[model samples]
Target chain A: MSAAPPVIDRLRARIGTPGPPTTAVVEAGHLKAFAEAIGDSYPRWLTEAPPTFLVALAPVTAHLPEAEEYGKGWLNGGNRFEYLEPVKVGDAITAIGKLVDVYEKTGSSGNLLFIIFETEYFNRHGRTVARLRGTAIRR
Target chain B: MNIEPGHELPDLIKHPTTRQLVQYAGAQGDFYEIHYDQEFARSVGLPGVILHGLLKAAFLGQLVTDWLGERGTLKSFEVSYRGIDVPGRPYRCRGRVTSVVGGRAELEVWGEDPEGNRTTVGTAVVELTA
Candidate 1:
């Protein structure tokens, strides 16, 4: 079998590169929209953000320029999330992210390249609201 | 809610449609074609337009929050995507309390298809008020 592609190495080299952070207010409308998008009709979201709503920060958290190139057929491996504080509507959120790691594995199916990254969301008062570590897989 | 070890939380079922995917794409800024365009999804070796993995994870998170009610806080949650699921099918999110110590409850949560195949598996911890 052939060796892993060179792109995998390029991704590995970018580890620790920080993505440009994004800032947005935790609006009730967006929260409601997200809840509705997931078919959730719970009333709690009217005033407070949903538990996983912070995943919307993907654009900021996953802003690596090289990531767009690997987007062709990549898959979301998964995510680990930790919630630190309740996000109320009208709070401002800033998401900062960086590429953590990249590696390859030769499994039963074939060769798979993985990218591991992390992001943190902070509130207006500079308190941590949530943290996320994610993985993207390319085969 | 009287959550105790071994108690199964209420199941949260979802019926995802392509329209919902579009709505999510707009709301979350994740306009990946594979999540809303059938042709693109097929080109990517998928059955059809698939739901966002984050959306599925959100459903599982909702399961915990809904069970915990207003007084609980989500401390941590994790999930690994095991399979791809297309829109237009019913997906179920369920969780069972593994332990309740002090003011925290630990749960084993997952999402599955109608066939009962696990697609997303993970665990979560919720801090409950005394």
Candidate 2:
């Protein structure tokens, strides 16, 4: 008998479907820890949210157990961030993530599954703050 | 500031460590074992707990921001991870102006491993403040 529909196909079914909106506040404490972790000592980072700080605000994509079954491990293929407005401390930001695309590619070692997800960030004022697109790979 | 193509941004070198990886994992709320758990990383065909692509993207972001430094605002930035890098090594960040037009500048940025491999590659677009 054929194996249960491959996990890649299972993941493909989720494209264009948004998960849920996650709301979070840009806290100063969290921003400090993130800059410290990155070892970036820029003084302004203490108050302003650095370029990647938004990812720290929320998960870009929901966890999919099915995708985990396909590969032994996961890799971050890439990420793109578009800033509409400055994200600063004390801004209440909400993030909504959705899978944009999923496909498979044959690499030298083996086959790889690529999942593309897009997330849009909005502040309490209802203005879009930033947009993030990331590619997660399973190999 | 006179911006021209081929101008290099000052380099920012980052020394990454396993401990920082854990710290970043907590800060980002990404608990994926591949980033902090060496055993799990090995199981997944990786050399060891590797740097997060977003972390590298952060480094490149700093590269542009440091150069722009109130001179402009970053409009967009992008990065693609081409290879895996482990901790305990210095990651070199570099960039150059690719073009500038109508008060907007485009830059080519990258992060290099010890051997000079462009493990993380990306670009940034910025609007220079008048």
Candidate 3:
């Protein structure tokens, strides 16, 4: 199956589309679990979540529902993260995701559609913590 | 550690188990079946249950953060998922200082499979205080 034209139209129609900002409280347990899962023994993770932890706030692929129309199989193209401030354990964080761009490119395997999404994390006091830009490929 | 250009950072070797993938799935709220279900992964043309690209990216982040130590701060990081890394295989995260100007240091980081392929490649900028 090829990339759906309707999906492309829907994506272009909503460029810079913003997602409902989601908020989650950073807890010590969650940090520990993540560190442990990655076998990271850094004590700092106990206090501050890992740099890439912000992506967990709202995974790029699942952040937008319109994306589901692309295809069933999904792959991560890449991610860029800018950390503004440390994410403390007791901090209340708000995550906002937006659809940045969409396009298709023909790969050696055939055709692949790329979707780019950007997510910003802010603390309860409105302090920016981190910003993430991710790309997902649908085949 | 001296924050200077041309310095090589220590390599971080990681062996992500299936159980760890499950834990990561739980912690990150990413229940993507391809990351934890071998059947689904194979059905989709993958060799097996591959580790999350974000997870592999995290490993690269750790490589820099661990090198920066306590006072150093991670300012910006980026990575491109070029290849798929299967579970149970050992992956090495390596990086080197590309340049240091003022208190800001830049690094080139990437993850390599057992075969020495650069599976994930990225650049990171860090703020360091001497």
lDDT of 1 by residue, A1-139 (tens): 9865567667777788777878988887888888888777889888787877887744634655565565357789999999998888898889888889888788677777788889899998899989989998876
**CA deviation > 4 Å runs, candidate 3:** A1-5
- State the lDDT of candidate 1 residue by residue for B1-130, as single tens digits: 5788999999999888889889988888888798988898899778988888999988898888878887778899999999988888999999999999999989999999999999999999998876
**Candidate 1: segments with Cα more than 4 A from true spot:** A1-5, A58-61, A65-72
Say which candidate scores most in DockQ: 2
Candidate 1 C-alpha error for residue B26, in Å: 1.1
- Scanning candidate 1 chain A in windows of ten residues, the lowest lDDT window is A57-66
Report the C-alpha displacement of residue B58, candidate 1, in angstroms: 1.2
lDDT by residue for model 2 (A5-47), tens: 9887888889988888999989999999999988888899999
* lDDT by residue for model 3 (B63-91), tens: 98887888678999999999999888999
DockQ of 1: 0.81
Residue B4, model 1, lDDT: 87
Sort every candidate by DockQ, greatest first: 2, 3, 1
Per-residue alpha-carbon lDDT of model 2 for B54-83, expressed as tens digits? 888888998899999989999999999999
CAPRI grade of model 3:
high
Best by TM-score: 2
